[model samples]
Target chain A: MIEWSHWLPILAMLPLVGGALTPLLFRHRPAAACFWAVSVASVTSVVAIALLLRLVDSGGFSYAVGGWLPQYGIELRMDEVGAFAVPASLLVLLSLVFSRHYVARAVDASRVSFYYALVLINLGGLNGFLVTGDLFNLFVFMEIFSVSAYALVATAREPIASLAALKYLLLGAASSLLVLFSVGVVFAMTGTLNLEDAAAALALSSPMPAGLALAGLATGFAVKAALFPVHFWLPDAHAAAPAPVSAVLSALVVKAGIVGVLRTLELFGGAESLLQPLLHLVVWLGALGALGGALMALVQRDIKLMLAYSTVANIGYIFIGLGLATASAVSGAMVHAVNHAVIKSALFLAAGAMIHRTGLRNIDDLRGLGRRMPVTAFGMAFTLIALSGAPPMAGFTGKWQIALGALQAGHPSLVAVLVIAGIVVLAFGIRVINALYFRPPARVAVASATEAPASMWLPVLMLTIASLALGLAGTPMLEFVGPAAQSIYGTLP
Target chain B: MNRRRAGRILTAVLIAALAVPLMYGMVQLPAPGHADAPAHTNVSAGYIERGAELGGSENLVTGVLLNFRALDTFGEVLVIFTAWLAVAAVAGTASNAERDPVPPSPVVDYVIRLLGPFIAIFALFVIVNGHVLPGGGFQGGVLLGAMLILLSLVMDAETVARAVSARSWIWLRATGVLVFAMVAVMGLPLAGYLFGLPDEPGLRQVLTVALELGIGIGGGAVLAGLFFAIAGADRS
Candidate 1:
């Protein structure tokens, strides 16, 4: 008689439920809609914290909706793996509360309301995807987030936004089709779409069907995760989207695919042996992406574009961690995912504020703006330090763990790659920082420079604080993230 | 003037050059597989047998809709709801305009008035016989919404707005899902999953009907809402 099971799922739905109701209740008052969105997200943040506490104390719980239970109906399973996602998703939504004013100034009125709705839906979808125990049900929520994301980008109404949306749409559709094809193959072989059931079936089956399914599923996730060659749509989409959308997309949405792949790996137990060569390929591709994305970012003039390319570099780091495929590496990857989201969101929002307040899109135009907007400049600086793996910051913690994990796995080359990429990151970050704080500002921006509204600064500030907190509280955070990795790697004992 | 002509010629030549490879690639690749596999068990045969056992109706599609894939249908209804809200936000029907554009022309209005009754009749038929028929909430809802979009095109946005606002549509959609989820939940302590009530045919039949009707109303309103929003934008 676990009471928490029922209540947790309900709590997850509160933001979604509020989002669904907001348009109706605040039909004529768009401002009220925004306020209500914040309230719902804030309430959800509290609930998520409570759930995190419960999970830490008692471990995790699973509840079957409608009481049909697994093998017959959908189930929401919350293990340590799922628990990690809850707080991350809550953190992303809470940041949106701060990103609202930036969005309001950047996007049109209709698009603003729609963007809030989509963000709420995205939060629900991401959380639902993590908690779900059923494979096909995961696909359903993935589609929900994908569709919302495509629409959200297009809402920018810039020509570049449309082009980016189109590219993302095509790539997303192709990736989804690949995923569906894998599900079909797996279901055909096992006669079940439930994760546990599929695992049970896989344990008894021949290698062929399992191999085919793994190949299809990995390809799908690789495309979504923006690994290597499939990374094309990412730079454009992130660069072209409004700052808040870019933040959410880079920090959270892309990680959904990473979560999918990790879940697949954990479920199918030597699902790896079937694709061992592919995993090696993933290592090299990730290394290449990391090096290439950083080099490209170094040459970019547009501040947002540089951050967008840097995200590709960050994603590559995540991939390298995953490809190591050991307990330590996987834990490193998960922690990095959380760390990257916090820092990346902060950076993007700060960049957006800089652009909005001064009407300057290029780094060269943002010269000596620290005097004009010290707070935004500081926020950007903090995120930059974290992104560059500075001491006592979230980014440093993730990189330290990953480097140790790489060394442990005997892949010392990856350490070199990480170091080189870190240098590239540092160089570009200093470039932006110098442009903002040291270089002489262009007369135009010097005249117009002012701070963005509190709505915008708040999210950016919270994210930067989170990045610092991650560094300072690395131990406790590692306690939770470590077990989550152990769960996925099947090395809990 | 000559430069413009030269530019047009250059563009045309580039297009032709691009189209050659595009056409060649389109023909050479293996076609996409969109068809359902035929190797599976004849689902219809099992469906027919079960349909008969459960006081089945003639519509096999409807039976499957209200039975096998009811949850997917529930989500489908939500997609429509999302579209409706999206449209309302775009239209701004409540402010700035007191009246809708003029009603449809004589011929279009005549056709709608003639078809409206029959359309209403068909919707009810689909909703009531969902457990026995091929058309369920989604298909029937689309049909209903299509008629409304058509009506608005011939009539005006104000007429449709007067009939229903964006606010009402969201309420209707939420109510539908809540009812469905509740019914599903209520059955949990007794029946199991939302629609997984029992093998005892009668209760399943009743639950199915109730769920479908709710979906139908929701589906219809969502369609109208979206159509109204798109049309309303064009009007302004």
Candidate 2:
């Protein structure tokens, strides 16, 4: 019998190793590279799903790297939080499948293999980040994904891509430095890099440095999560990248920031004095982000830019749920993270397909695409409504739960905020739907455009179905992540 | 102009406000080198005590880096490799037509050539002696990279490129991640966990040295690749 715990490390390693070999083995053959990358991601997805199943059956487990106990060496664990690898790997796999035909035009020929390699490496980093129990390892995995994401943004052929990537790189580097510095501070205080051990130590430590570390980590992760006031870099970077890269960025990458924040909350669970103020502040910031991001998204002419802003809006909703610190609210936030990832990636890929076919990105220009490309347009339209938190769709479960939790927590104003944001989101969704199905073709590109290939539409279609299915599955998901929220927050109201 | 100046002033004010708490936090941390500081007593003490016997290196740093926290080192190595991969993907290899028109002076060229062999040997020494020495794969690899960069400065990049085929160069660049991964997996059967150094002393030593050499060569190649990508030596 296999010691299934061993699979945890391999979950991260397989992709990293496979990615490292992609360019070496398929440098000259991009089609082969796509096949190779998809194969590796598929295998990784299998491993991730298997591990998640084991976690469900057996509860959470840990694997100490090199046989050294957690205190002396790194530990990789699979809790409900780490079970995020399942969706993350699945999303990357779909994105890779979508990339087969997309990259042929979106990226330069010689760099195709490198594009696939970087995406795989980014998944590897994200998976590693989700599983690792060591603080420094968290920082390392963050860099691996971050560096790849920066480069992935630049892989687009647009002239603005380089500047956007540079902006992202600079801000990302600053955030990473903050995280590393905080890690240093924690290490100095606790002398142990293990998250559990350090958390125990921090519970009893002096407040000043502990508060600083908490502040640094919260701010750093907030920036990465694109919380309001620090989300300036996201719109440009996400909007400018190739569509599949954008999907990955807006979907899995930013959620890693949320995961980071969750880990921070777990680390400081015992330090309630420091957490309360931060939580209170983030709630208002989240409200601002929810409103501001929705309004910005509504006004965008470019379809991709609108989607990018919507990501910020959704991130805002998740943060609000997190900040409320109620059981339902936190679980709602966690479930919403997964739902938003599914819905947003579906939206991005469908948008990418339209853009790929017509080379048009403006909402007005993509008018009448409904007739020209039925499947892609419908997927986009369905997911768009789902994205608006409409009932019986993926977005509704989390928003409703969050609103319930807000009222439960005596923050009725936040429920109003959630409703207003939802309505604004629905307004944009209607506008886009009207353009696609009602408005006549206004541009030559729209009139001439055809549906994208099966590779592209298949993934979009799958995620579109998933967005609805996940909504129906919401109760179970909330139940699943219930323990995780409880464990991370340590007795939430 | 007044508004811009006011904005600058506001920025400075905010930064200063931020720095006050940061500095205060720094001051409250246990002072450096304090005998009882957690940095000295907790995990570090364990590493100091048993690192040589359990971690399989006389140099505690190497023991920790290679045996105790080997996964982080592997990640660091992958990070470097990914850095080169990213640069190559973004900027692309420079076309041969874009090569520098200026040629190097004979004196500088001769001096670089003279120093190259010794630098290479010293890098090998540092890497191989990492079990007992301060300098290991990363440091030695950096030296090797510097030598390559120096050579490229004086010699034709085409000549340097031709020394190894493009395919082989890529494999060499991937050596660190690949070899580290291989050793890590080997530990599953031999030492009962991923990234574990084998309990057999002789075999463990061999695997550690192999990891150092792989990382050394791989890091050196990736650094040189980054330089080439920036300098436009990549024809592909």
Candidate 3:
């Protein structure tokens, strides 16, 4: 049997090829674009899973493009962290699968094929971003996805959609520039762009430039990850987007920032003093983010806006795990990244299905949708619990580890913030749940609304079940990430 | 200010507070580009020592881009291509119905008509000579793209449309990525690396030129496609 992952380059390239061929394949057959895009994403996801499995079994491997030596070339290195491509690709796959019917109603008919094309390109960009080990290449892939995301956000037919995308473009572009500036700093300091070499080299150098580089990298990724205080653009951008677009943005795209932060942490493994203060900064920022995001989320009337703010809070959770900077904490961050990608996408897709059916955006208008749309309502409920960190779900697994790690790292205070954020999340979850199940229907349209098509509801159900499965079988997942986490934290250079 | 505005002001203040540590960190960095800097030591020394021999290009930048660090260039190529996709999606007005281009001022049209051929030749030269010279895929691609827009400016849309119809234009626009991907696949069978060019000098030359031509042609067409899309001249 062929070693499937040896074709990793092709696996990432496959989507770009599909994206390039989409307009050709579906020029007149616009309806087939969705199917084509879905097929491409599925293949990419399969390969990503295969690669992750390989990494889990044999540890990860590196591929040098053009066969150049590490000192002179770009390296695509996949470890436990890089296995993020699996969830990222799978989430993109689900979103596109959900978009088949959703896109017909949500977007202009003429641009349907183009929409799928953008999705494929975005998928390609994301996979490439996760796998590449070179810093500048990472920035390059960041732009690829960011540019596609900006357009996708504006793909919806509204003035505000374009306006929101423009604001996103401005802010996102600024983040990208900051990332590039840091890349330049590293390149100037180390004469190399490869992450491992740059890190090893910087370990021997003065701390001043290294600190500057770290600061730049952190600030840039903070914006991308939507950390507290810098999260102003997220609500408008996420809410205004077409739902599938928002799902992926909320789910996988922001994870890119966390991935970047982790990579930088790993790269500068020997710089303990630098990482110490950075982690301290991260812990406090994450605390504020969690508290602030939940507080803001509680007041939102629009369901999607509430979900977006909740994402900010969850990002805060992940950053807390990361900022604790213990092996367990980093592991928790990784697990949460995976869990949130699944839960949040499921929630967004469910929300999208409901919105598609009844066209209600506000939580109040969606009252009693549980009776009308049983499957989506239940899916949303499971996702809400997952989001709020309830026990016996993926959410609790990550939160438990992170809280334990916070104590391990001697930060008892973050655990308090964790509790507070979780409670607030519970309050909002109850609000949405009450609207879905407990309350009487205020709108006749919502009262009579039927379930979305199988194509739509099936993905929501599948993702929800996947999250539950991940939680129940959470031990094995943690075991798999165990080596990867230990490798990152244990052998810090 | 009202409550919302006050809250916004508070958040802005907090954001600034967070950025202060970062500014302090920047201030602490050594000034960039000193010969004694950490970056000038490790991998930089090695690349400078043998990049040409290893990468088989006379020009070090081209060698690094085409052979050593080709993946980054590939990602950059994809980034620009994605940007074109985004631009087309947002503002693309190109319909299938080809419309006549309004005539431009004689001076402008005549100048472009006269210089377009030379510019095209120069772009080809830049791409072809990239292995031995400064300009490679991106520079040549940009030059060629600029030339295409210039040609379109002087000649009517209908004239260009007839030469490369909307249907054929799709393939043309994808030529860069397709050719790049194809060559990448071919590398697997040829040199046992996905983006590897052959180690043989002649083969390296051939592969580098082929990549240059592919990127140049593809990038130029995509740029022109963006122009048409934004100008609303594209039709399915």
Candidate 4:
């Protein structure tokens, strides 16, 4: 019998191969392409879920590609971080289901198959990035997902989409170059591309090159994650992409950057002197991003832009938890990564459904849509509240833990930033909710709009329910990522 | 204008500040090509010591690329394919209405035609001999792609496109990913791991050659497809 560990590589390969065949087999038949893409994602989700189950049952495991040892070849490992493939696959699946209707209008008909193909390829890249233990493989998978994401941003028919995509591509390419350069640096210093082996070597190597690698990696991933000070490329790119595309970008892609940082921390875990200052600096950056992103979101007119800035704010929260380097803080950050992904995707998809039905994107323009498109409107309103850190919802769990962590770390002032940012988040959420429900219909489309099709609203409703469920399951979720935090940071405060 | 100039100056100053530590880090690294350098002493030493016997190819680079770490190469191949997909998805395939106004010069066209067959032969040799020689799938594929582009430049793009059907073109472009996937799965049952080469020398050589061919053909087709999409060829 084949060991369950063997399925690890399949988690990534299945989607990649399925995606590669999509355009070949269903170039003209877009509906068939969507069906094929969703089926592949569904299967990938099953494989990822199975791997997660095995990981929980037996702890972490690694598979050597091509039967070579880890030191000599690529290794795909399933750990708590790799378990992220579960949500990544499921979100991509929902987005694909949602895209069946959304893409018909948002993208050119000639490119529908290509769009589905790119999404699948992007998922494959993310899965591969999550599981791989080799430094070079990490860079390769990053490019795979990064390239597809840049292209997906351009698939929107809007006039600004290409420009936004160009901006995204330019920055993304530069970040990727930085990462590749760091990989080269690590190899030069250590002579091994294996993460475990390199980490061992880096522990004994000179500090200067190791520090450079760390800085290069941290900056590269920060750009990808859209952390403050380098986040200028995010608002336009996320806002201009199609809604489902935005959901994937906001939900999974940015999280990959955080994962990259976690991997960097793991690689340099032995070098505490190098990490201390970096950790301290990121806390301030995270605080600035949290407050600044929330404030920026509060002022946005475009609904998607608001959601985009909200993502930046959530990323800030995650970073703060990471920077604290306490058990509760780091675990809270990891849990929040998943929670925020679900909440953000729900918001984007609901916003997408509204735009699909009414062709309006302004918060004020969507007045009184609650009664007209009840399911989509309710999903959006509910997720928006949850996004603002309301109790018994996904956002609250992470914030509460992160706050407790701040006090534990003796950084009580950071709690003020959290609270103020949370309030600003709530203010914007309430503003959108008020316009959605309390105000009178201000546009003809809002007054006349009907509910979106089942394909669109069902995913939104499912994610809305998931956001609530994940909140209740927060304790167990925290425990699940507990060991990961310890393993990544060596020892927490 | 004054503000822009100030911004540029500030950017320069910041870059210079950043460069100081970067240069310090670079200068501290062990010199390249030294016997004691980590690059020479670590994992590569093992690769050099036993690669021919265990890695299944005489050329250590190809052996490592196709055997030891095939997954990275697979990702690289997919990246190339995705690049073509992105181009086709974004800019779209060329329409019939848009055509090149200036025709190719007769002399240049004839010379390209004369050289195409020889280039094709050379690329195939490079691809097939990759296990022992310096050239490999990527190098050979680039050559093959350039030949196709050269042919397209000299001939009517439509006539060149008609060389293969629209349906066939996509399959050709996907050859790298499909074949790599097939080989990867086959490895699980045959060699007990994904992407493994069989222990049998003949079978391993066949699989390696097959991989080189797939990557070469797929990469060349995708490259030509990219040129066609950008140069206003048939929409296929």
Candidate 5:
């Protein structure tokens, strides 16, 4: 009876069942754990694609659990934006595929199954969050993924990893509580947890309670997304986490917060008094984050940490687009979210491969690797160019769209912040390119390093190619997400 | 005033000043128990009026928790399970059979021995009656977990270890989410949609009870496992 249209929820749950089985199946055969995890995520990706196509064909759909009508029962809703789950799951799959050799080397052998299990669980939580329409359901899904992320970040077994994970755990848990508090407030105001119902109810009600609830939800998501002034914990946590885990964290987990913000905008779009002010705040904070994060990235010598800070900056770019609250701007933000997920994961995996080959984290230590690890070097270099908002890569399309959006919205000053931030990011990226391709080896390990195995580099290369393909053929993505932008802000550019 | 004192006072005043609007908003909220309150006039009224037929549980709370907002409950179950996995991943799985057993305390041991069976049965009763009564899976599971911890507290570690192997503990702790997910998906065919219960009142009742038991058992096992692991009771 489900046919193909109702497949969105299944795409989320399949990885969950696989997560439940992975540990038990690989109790003695730990190697199979990675394979099991990839197979599950791959299956979820395929189904996600099928679901995406079906939803596009049929337009959009919603499934109310237990056949109970909305405003009463939980709903699983999918529109163009929710289809972001497709890219999220595919990126996670690629990360897991890259994780096999990396985890075997980076993590303790005995704990490999547990690591893979957490990865699958994180994937499930993310996918579920993407499609859920209930506020409390979102909180619950957020917790599911955040808890696993806290754990997986520490799986690296380094002392710093543990400390950073603990910090992340405390902050993340506090933010989730804030999110829950906001959900409670919204429920109290509207008496319905379904987002569309609540939004309609909020539109009819006074602005005060909705405003407070908005404050709570904004702070919570801002913390989750690592927005400026609240991103204090990201660099350490992302840098200290295992490379594969870093890829997942930087690429998808951070985007979860921005996704939450967009959903909130869509839900509250009709409440102009509330949304207008919040969107203004989002714009300023995003501008600050873009500048601050890039400056911070500019000072970091560790390539992973630099990537981590750059993630904070890239997040700023997406937020600025989203906060612009215009059709083209939000579309750019959405497109950027997808592009960053691809390019950043490629960056992390490629950087992870270098570290795996040479055990060096500092950019200077990894100098001359372009000659040694040719494919990985190419991946790292190309991702850098793409990420710095240069031409010929997918990253430029989103930034351009956002800048163009600023022009459309009559806020040309924000374009200044975008350009300045881009230059900072570009400068940092160029330094790394210089080190990787131009500078002489700084250590013996760098001079003697060999190329990473195909299991490791293959996914990185695929992602790099994906980064190019998505950039060059970005019109389809923009068109696909156009309706989502229109849903929040009525007209399109 | 000194600069530091001035700064501190200024900061406090600013914070309080900022909070005035929020406090003013709260003061304007509808009085508790008002008939026209949003909480009563909106969706809660529908749940109370029709949750039984719509959600298939006598207890409206359970109806909401299990059927109306089943995905939320599903997510809740995943949260707990993920917590256990996170802790276990950071701290490896325990092997109590190899550990040095703590000596049993005589009087406390006798007390737990007498109370353990009754507590176990009571937990089961709570879970089964959850649809009609106040107690449910989470409460029953905590009680069950408390019983095991109490047993571990008063008696030898070996007894608990013999009763539940480390491997069994992992599966039992995981059973909650695994079962919940399986049932949610199974709803597609068994009923009509994901997490949809059969419209038949009888079948819905059966599945809810099954879900309750799964949650109870899984929660209890995880609580015990998490505690015992943290207490160093199961460390090899």
Candidate 6:
């Protein structure tokens, strides 16, 4: 009978600690390594669901280790925000687990353990980043996650992987530097590195420096979240990474940055009037990322690269909701984050499995996949429908909320951009779906062109189920996200 | 296998095995209290303080890093992490291991032979004394990493790898984060904050020292591992 609070930390650590120990224990046993890794991840998923239940019943709880107090020691402050990320992270982590067999077969045998370790660390980093209350701790966790990501992307040893890793490394380093400088500036001015304390300090201080600090933070987070002008590293990096990594990267890592920016805004926005201008800029940038990324995706021949660009486009929708900054809009963004994580992770893993089966990554080369690999083809189709914001899907509910928020905000221009972007998204989505499912088989089916093994398809199935479940049964979720959105925008007055 | 060589290697391994844990375990011991005695606020206020201060600087650590003791931390640790990355990237692209041309300089070699052990000891002292003194673990750990790097450059990559394996170094790096997270998470319950080390002077100092040891191990290992990664790239 483990206490509920203990479950929260354990859920984050099980993957991480398991990752660190995997190589030592199973360096010689790939099957055993996969079994253990999946077990850890599955347990984490169950724990996350359990933790969410505790949150619903108890509201927010803070757990301190070594009997230390919040002001003086480190803590895990689990609030509505922390609760919100649990299901999403669990869904993604489980997908990574489900994709293990596909990855083991597709990737080098010697690197299998290392790959699982990186996945576990990525999960731990994401969960820790979401849950931690301290600013510096968040940065530390961000580095762990980013470092693991850099290596995971380059692990394939493809030329493109190296180039993408280098590109991501440079941008990631720049983002870290910007964040460090901003943290330093904020600490110097406020004499506190805690988010809530810093928020109060900013409210009391003059606007000029505080505004500058906010700009530094926003720009840094924007680069991580890969919003329009700062999103150049995303396509190459995502396209080059191994499939499960791509799913986690696009679905989860980028959202962590969005969470960071949202947290910053929540703590500091109330007292500052300059935030409105910032919100305006985000709206425009979101519009551009959506339109530009979708247009770019339309021309790509590589399926992975095309999906990567679509990620940039999907990210734009999130920013648009965030920019709207209304209760419903913010809730929509939160919901979208969870929805995208599930759908995108499922799609990428399915794409990876397809590639694994066929030994091809290009759209043209993927002909007849639907006939040969029905499960993957069908899964990808379901994901595409969700990605396209089709009805009766997770993506639709999020977009619906964004559209409603835009209407409430009286921003017709933003609404027009959203509508146009939606069309572009639908266009590219159909282009890929057509190439995947409708295109005739150019080559006879090989024995390899079957549905992925149960391990790989299981998580994909889970994510697909989540996407549909969230879409169909969102009343509870909508209610759950409401208090969180209120915390961000303070219940609209 | 050569008997004498095996015996020497055995001896070296034994020494390392014993020494490494001793080094870490020592940092876990109780630490001294924060200095309570008043000192001159400005450098010009005292003779000893004057020489330690930068001409225009007010903050001591910033002054030490940017001015007087700058080469050790800023120049050595931070710059070296950058240099390792640079070498790794360039050498990785060249598809060859980059080699240094000159042999070890006798003068510098002799100096390190005499002073290396003492210098490492002094660096540890500074790290442990950070609360009362100006220097902290980051600077000290960099110095330690620099020492390993120097040995690697003067001796060989194999020697350095033998001294501390890359696998263990990576573990050390992770351990640093785990330790920090543990300490911070520990603070969540009673302290109402993360990493809020108790104000009881003795306990606080002890905690700080433990934290420093973790940092030192982590920073040192990262520096060593980065070098190994870059240097080992030649094999690929």
Chain A of model 6 scored by TM-score: 0.95
lDDT of each: 0.70, 0.94, 0.83, 0.93, 0.85, 0.68
Candidate 2: Cα lDDT at A76: 94
Q: What tens digits encode model 3's per-residue C-alpha lDDT throughout B12-101?
A: 999899678657666655555666655666666666788788888888888878777777777777777777777767785435455544
Question: Candidate 4: which stretches are off by over 4 Å?
Answer: B1-8, B93-98, B234-236
lDDT of 4 by residue, A121-167 (tens): 99999999999999999999999999999999999999799999999
Q: How good is the docking of model 5, by CAPRI class?
A: medium
Q: Tens digit of lDDT per residue, candidate 6, span B9-83?
A: 999999898556444433332222323211122211232364233211333453333222221221122222323
Q: Write the per-residue lDDT of candidate 3 for residues A1-493, one digit (tens) a residue.
A: 5445456676668887788778767866656998899889999988898888788778778887777766677888777777888888888999998998888888877777778888888888888888888888889888878888898998877678888899899989998888898898788777788888887877776787688788888888888889887888888899888899999999988888888888788777777777788888898888888899999999999999999999999999999988887778778888988998899999899999999999899999999999999999999998898888887887888888899999998888888999989999989999999999999999988978999999899999999999888888777877777766766643432
lDDT of 2 by residue, A126-173 (tens): 999999999999999999999999999999999899899999999999
Q: Ranking under lDDT, best-scoring first? A: 2, 4, 5, 3, 1, 6
C-alpha TM-scores of all predictions: 0.84, 0.98, 0.93, 0.98, 0.95, 0.81
Tens digits of per-residue lDDT for model 1, A341-378: 88988998888888778767788888888888888889
Model 3 spans > 4 angstroms off:
A1-5, A489-493, B1-41, B93-104, B154-163
| DockQ class, candidate 2 | high
When sorted by DockQ, best at the front, the candidate numbers are: 2, 4, 5, 3, 1, 6
Measured by DockQ, the strongest candidate is: 2
DockQ of each: 0.15, 0.91, 0.59, 0.85, 0.64, 0.05
lDDT of 6 by residue, A187-241 (tens): 5555555567667666776555566667777888889999999999999999998
If both were scored by DockQ, which would come out higher, candidate 1 or candidate 4?
A: 4
CA error at residue A385 for candidate 6, angstroms: 0.9
lDDT of 4 by residue, B1-236 (tens): 99999999999999999889988998888889999999889889999999889988999999999889899999999999999999989884335577788988899999999999999999999999999999888888888999999999899776777799988888998999998899988998889999998999999999999999999999899999888888867374
